[model samples]
Target: IDVDKSVDLTNCDREPIHLLGHTQGFGCFIALRFDWIIAYSSANTNDYFGADSDDVIASPLKNWIDPQTLHDIRSAYQASTITGRNERLFSRAIEATGVPVDISIHHNGTFIIIEFEKITDDRVPEDSFVRSMLSQFHRYSDSQELINSTAQYIQFLTGYDRVMVYQFLPDGAGEVIAEAKNENIDSFFGLRYPASDIPKQARALYLKNLLRVIHDVDSEPVPILPEAEDAEDSIDLSFSTLRAVSPIHIEYLKNMGVKASMSVSLIINGKLWGLIACHHYSPLIPSYFVRTELELFAEVFSLELSSRLMREREDESNRVRNVHNQVMASIGSEGSLLGLLEKQFDTMRALIQCDGIGAVIDEDYRTAGTALSADWVHQLTRYLNRQASSEVITVDSLEKVLKNYDTSSDKIAGVLAIPVSKSPRDYLLFFRMAQTQTVNWAGNPEKPVSFGPNGSRLIPRSSFALWQQTHDDRCEHWSDVDVRSGDSLRVTLLEVIIRHFQERSELQS
Candidate 1:
């Protein structure tokens, strides 16, 4: 259905970007050899030092930094994992004019990299305020509430027009679960964004870099110069604060009528759970101080969010455990297999929150609730059981995974099939109806990636006409809570069946 299983994402993750020989305009990066000679630098050296890119080449790194500052950096770089040193200065006449520069130093194995970013934000959000903000976050009882509050607080803190908590779903796609927007901005709440928006490699980098900000989307990117001789030797800007973004991403933002953007990663247990995406109608560059505070807030928020999610899972598990008990009780007092199941049909259906529930014993069927005809049920069950493992078989899209099924006639898009006994092919299947969702795509989701005049490289979509399309025959995904119920049901039913069969065998003997 809406599950796109065939599209090639080859370009999404393999975008060899750090070698693009450039950086963003806000900062200038320098790579130095151990002997203090400049090895590589962004071509836009004029922005910071008013020197040609080559001016840094063969020049002692000391010339760019005062002796005291150089000594501090050397001490900090002694350990690879000690964390980098960050200090700011009112750089008087270091370049065309006096401005604030946030200087940073770190080592990347091959080279000692230094970066200078022009800072505009003079004052960061205060510590007391951060604590108060965090205290308010703890007041929230659930993850969704915490995220919703985070969206509002981030938008308020950063002064962006809109902020959204875009949570990734099981299948690469994502949904905006929480959003806070200015009165004039459009609502993106509940809108599902395809995985193509954020490719796999980009996601990996988000874990490494907490904050990615683009002050001016239209500004040209600074290129890295003295092009790296070998692609492998190219700097992996996976950690670069000013790493240039992919051209396609810039175009994608432009089409959405956004001028500036920032994303703060929401990392849960070291993996990215979502992003706090901020968008502005005009260019907005929060100072390094403000961004630093944002990063701290994001890290703390991640820990808080993790705690809330764990609580939710615990609550769900308890509910499932209770359902497990009731289902076992019904099966344990069995008369006829079909009659016992039919009596507890409501409980079984609620266990997974499906459109219908079905049971097939051997080649025959006994079912309750909305389901396909007996013949179709048998066919679907046989097909799913073959592809299934000992664990629960979860199908979000029957058509995509089971190619032999008649897609046109099937109203059930997803199925959770569990085997109670395989000898007679007894199965308890939960079915979900196709949920045709609506999406307001920035461009046609179907034509998300196109080609430029060269007709080789993938380009961003050319349109932003508020394209609305009904997603394919997909259903609300089965959550872990639902699967837990199935797991309990399978174990309980299997035990009862084995015991009953043993008693029958003993009587016959």
Candidate 2:
């Protein structure tokens, strides 16, 4: 009987019956004695006949077995079975049959856990797996929740620490969208990293190596193929999995206090959207089988997220196209134009994920929009005039460009400037919360002190709460990207606001 039990075989009750056990299952056989006993991957039990030998399987078990009885059993079994000339040979032939038990024992009573090899999808239809995965995505597409349900589903499929959906700005800065993580871990939902954190070179590299796993940052190095050194651009995976942890990156992670890292790229419309970062508390090297499984899962997630985003953007673009036509018809009517253009702020707010929404646009190209505050308007007008002069304009760092602006107002930390039309003249401006907030973390701000080979002391990390000195900084603590599904509540509220603007624009126009 090809009996298969999910529980460890050694833990099963085979009492009162003499048993022949091998490898991990040998423990059960040790509790009973039969007329004749045949064991493999087991140790002699003379030292503690009544005691468990699970801890000392490394030593020979020959001491416990009666030599004459063992010899007789070996001769009889070999004669009856005619399996092979030697016990080791028989074990090898059995293992070649792809049976798990073969790896559990050898005739000499030694145990060896065969290095698990690869699992090919050829044994299972690839199309069926992909189709099954797509079926899982249906729940997300059918929902109206603004939270990154797409990211959440991916996290479920791939067992990784908080699978976060991160949005990367052109300058390398990024924000977390959705995340799910271990309950004990403190969230990094709203934390922001400077553009320098992910340099241009790193971003480019991600395009080709879409998935990466850095397990056991402190593990010993596995050298590459010595003969392949002459090939300049060759990628050798032979021993890459065993490569040593990078010193530079170790220091980088130590600075961030991240022990393990795995990342999958999210591409939308052939553009980089963000990444799904999986973190671990200790060294965790996943086998190739697990890595492939995650990659397959991530690919499905990227496709779904891209498809959904494209559909939504298409709907918005179509609405905008129709609305623009209506606004043209009512160009002379200021109230109609105001209603038609009122949604500009809402759209900008959605894209940037801001707290406050405000816009400045000309009524028939006449006046600017309402001022957030008297001081805010003054700074905005000057910035708008500067935008008018540039033929081709794109604002990368609004904080740096708008330094003269009064960002000190309320919770406004960032601004979104969008040109209303192809013409570069005075255009629309939106205000909102900046991605990075000023916070006063509870612990020491300085990085941990380090002791070098020569015992040199290192400085600790910075923990000053200086970023949160003002009222604006206390508004929100963004979650790490993957765990932001709970933030759907905010997105739902914004959807209503967006609907209001869409209705007013259509009706008033």
Candidate 3:
């Protein structure tokens, strides 16, 4: 916890989420080989199974559970192993104790780890709960509404002080789009956090593991017993919901004044698009029943999110398609590329999401909207043709690529261009004006100072002050969908050009 002492900041990413060799104090962790021999235990199995940790380690799974239970478990375990899936066994109460426990089986490549989570009965049917959540999703019209409901629902279920839907931008940085919190806490809605706050590997881990909980940052981590000398001997907990957290992250959370926290992954297309980040101002841990409910809710919400996002993309694609058809129709009738292109200039610029567009064919040039001067456009077009790599070239910063032209950045900061013909140097280009804006960050997001406890090692920054930056060289960002639309338009233009050439040849003959 010493800020002056140095620590290897890189280890935050290399901490091996899979082989953490520990568990958060919410469950009994037991590991067994494929042959059913016990490999390791969390040393706290007595609280759950009435057996000593050492007694369970060197025994078979059949010693504690009945044969029927082991058979059911082994069969489910074997099936999941083949499919690379996880399965939850039954929930049963301890003999004469009335304490309910939920068991789940998942493989970690080396051993099949079984977790026994002590849970309280909520009496809510799984199907009913899922249907209720899904029904709520279908009622929402857009992603923003759904995210708002999800944050509120999670906050209600977990009783957290604040719950926010943290979505990642094109860059690794994140923004809180939807938030639900108690009146006492300050709002973090719309606040942007730097990418380094959650390192790259940590995000990968969140994708692999759906949920992670830190019950109390102040509690000491309970290390795995008989710690092996070699790292290979350690048990992997990549799929573990109760894996102990990293100390660096603990300090990071403490700096934010968050004593406890949990995150539910919001995945889209097998990738992490966002997270339901819940923060607690004080130590508060939900029972396994509540945790399980929130995890299920997140899964259902992710599917709905994927569907909504696809619809939005399809809407954009349809708009581009309409403009493509309109432009093609005009060009087909006129046959004079410059005349037709000038007539449909506004629609073409809209297709590319740009304010200006320019086209050149057989030395006939046309410009519209906020386009640069014709002379400058002609020079830029010639330069672009010489340096062209593909049929469609996009540059977010044109000045960097075209260093010879210092005056070009005033009007044409970014460009998306498509080559219609090579011999005549014919092309269509969409230009975006220079746009500058402020970027807010959670912290400075720089490399940690090296003068710490471990000889000149990297340590986490202690202050989480709000930092802002102003940019000048960058223009409006381009999306993959935008590039695809441009690519499709290029193919259409090529086909039209081919047909136009064929018609001219026939007339000449």
Candidate 4:
């Protein structure tokens, strides 16, 4: 654990978070076998239930709960087993403590985990409020507006100091697309954070558990009783609501001056898209009912966001398809491939979103718009022929991939090259001009380590002041839609080439 020697940024990803063998102090945890015998219990369970861990272990769960409550627990366990999702019971009073608690139940491979937190608020959101939010979402055709409204609504509902829509970029890094915060606090909107900030394993856990809350970052973690000697064999708390926070993550929040925080995952197409991250300046824990409401809101928001994105992509695709059809029609009537391309190069450039277009068929090479010199095009084609294997090649920075070319004064930064034929090594190339962007980060992404209370281990940076960075020699990345369009054009051009060969053969015959 020596920060100066063994610990580095990568250690964050290697941390065994799921086997932490602890729970937050505000809640208690109990794990039972399918046969209803207790297998594991939190060390602080007696503080709420007044039963010792030694006595609780190896005992039937029915010994603690009334018959009716036991039946409800069984039913909930059955439902969870059927659906492969967590089941919950809200505002149920335990027989031993007579305290109303919110219970969450889920099963891992070997045990069924039940977590209990004392109920502080029982009010559910009004039906009208939720309906109004849904109505507002439908009214906005733009995704940015929708996301902004979502952040505002969440801040209002949770009474958090700040709420942000943290979106994962094409690269592993994240950007704050929208923000709602108190006037006193500085805005984090449009700020970027490196991928290492939230390591790969942490992102994976977020996918498994949709919502996470840290009531108080400064509170001590309650250990699980009968701690395993081997860390590898410790209890798996992947889905536990009361799972202890990672020490590194706690240090991170402390550095940000955050006392409490919560995040709800935004999932699209079964992949983790981003997070609705909330920050509180002081310790705060929302009631279970309210947290559930927030979960529902996030779910609806994800669906709406996914729909809007898909619709936008479809609109762009339709526009490209129209241009493609026009080009194909002209080629069919003109009965020439390269000739038609040369004549209608302007229209062909509009088929995909790019600054320039080029085509290499056998020996003849042609280009249009802001393209490279003929020699450069020929060299690019040769490079593509050597690197590509019947698939499209996309590069956002030509300098990084293509060598021997003087890129110091190169105007074109990106390329999407599609191979049309293998024999002649013909290609259809799309080019994009270089662009410069200024990015504001919360802190220096390069320097995320510092010595802290826990010896020389790596800790979060102490300051979150704005750190500006300028990026150069890159272009707007070619999106999936662009790749699809390029592939479609390649297929149609291949068809046209085959048809011309067939017609010439018939004439010769």
Candidate 4: worst 10 consecutive residues by lDDT? 462-471
Candidates in order, TM-scores: namely 0.83, 0.49, 0.74, 0.77
- Reference-based TM-score, model 4: 0.77
The C-alpha stretches of model 3 lying farther than 4 A from their native spots are: 1-13, 34-37, 49-52, 60-79, 89-100, 120-128, 168-175, 183-204, 325-382, 397-400, 404-414, 420-477, 488-509
Model 3 vs truth, CA RMSD: 5.8
Model 4: clashing residue pairs?
none
Order of quality (lDDT) = 4, 3, 1, 2
Best by TM-score: 1
Q: lDDT of all predictions, in order shown?
A: 0.72, 0.41, 0.73, 0.79
lDDT of 1 by residue, 1-509 (tens): 14233434455578775555567888888888899788889988766766788887778877776666677667656743365433333232233334457665667656787777775555543453467678797588788888888888888877999999988877666788898999987788887766667888788878877888887888988778787788666786766777787776887787778999999998998788999898999998777666777888889988988887888878877777777688666554336676666677787777678888887776667767667668677667667667646778787777776656653476777888888776556778888776553233334555444445423534444322111222355666788767877988888777767766666667669
lDDT of 3 by residue, 20-123 (tens): 67788877788887778787888677887687777778788877776666777788888878867566765655442345777777887888888877764555
Q: Whose lDDT is greatest here?
A: 4
Clashes of each: 8, 30, 5, 0
